[model samples]
Target: MKKLLYIDANVNRATSRTERLAQALLDRLRANEDVEVTTLVLEDEGLAPLNSARLARRTAGTAAGDFSDPVFAYAKQFAAVDEVVIAAPYWDFSFPALLKNYLELLCAQGVTFNYSDEGVPTGLVRATRAWYVTTAGGYCGDYDYGWAQVDALCRLYFGIPDVRRLSAEGLDIVTNDVDEIMADALRAIENEPL
Candidate 1:
């Protein structure tokens, strides 16, 4: 079965606009395919940021070819997925710290990516496509560092050739209709090519 990995970084799980949009998109995608979806909720995962000790453990594990360590679990899953979808609300010019921490673990060398003989990076991830869904209170314009980072990771590290983004901006603008903005974003998601 085709495996789709959904990385949820929506802090406001129950009422997050980004989560709502991502769910709508995922529902449509599911309707069109026989894919198995697996979700990773970053907020509830209790992932610790990489530190000296954790880095040492990861290094040793890689050297020993023992990826049975819990820290490498996410990376293994990430590398094996056929597709990826990340839902995260824009915050303070980026996504939440929880997602960043999760990515650190998922980007483990010898797992998600490795180096070529000439030192070029080679992605080990099996995913062919990825989607990033997000909502911004104000206009993100050119300051969308979160999506940029995700796109870079998908292309440069995950070997996902197609990375698309769906976003709703100006949600907090006093003059804009929130429902309309969200509807437009959902429509974009619906119209996206799977």
Candidate 2:
């Protein structure tokens, strides 16, 4: 079975349009019956950005090639996954800070990546593809830095070759039909490849 990790950072669960899209994606993946999905709701994790002491400990652990610490659990799980899906609402040119915090912990060296003898960083993750889902109240245009950051990280740092994004824009525009916009996004999700 393929291990798929769904990292949910959408805060407004009560009225989250992003959650609808994410659920669509999950439903599509589950249809194959060969995928095992693991959901990680970021708000529930209570993850924090690494502190000075934690950073020092991580540095030491990486240098010593020791990855037995509980702090590496997230990285290990991420590295072992066959697929990843991130759902976060667009905010201030990027996703939520909660997703960023989770990412910080998942970027552990010798876990998600390693330095080559030539001093270049090589990815260590097992995932072959990832999907990033987001919804914007207005047109993101060239300012969707959230997807850009994730795309680059998955490809350059995590070696995921087929990183893709699904976004619903202008959902809050009074002129746009929110129902139609969401229905279109759902159609796109239905056509997404496994």
Candidate 2, after superposition: displacement of residue 35 in Å? 0.9
Cα lDDT over the full model 1: 0.90
- Cα distance off (Å), candidate 1, residue 20: 0.5
| Residue pairs of candidate 1 with colliding backbone atoms | none
> Residue by residue across 97-161, what tens digits does model 2's lDDT show?
99999988988999998888887878999999899999999999999998898988889888899
Taking the tens digit of each residue's C-alpha lDDT, what string does model 1 give over 1-194?
Answer: 88999999999799999999999988988988988999999988898899998899899998898888888999999999899999999998999988889888988888998878898778899999899999999999989899989989889877789899899999999999999999888888788876
Clashing pairs in 2: none
TM-scores vs. true structure, each candidate? 0.97, 0.97
Best candidate per lDDT, number? 2
Tell me the spans in candidate 2 whose CA falls farther than 4 Å from its real position. none
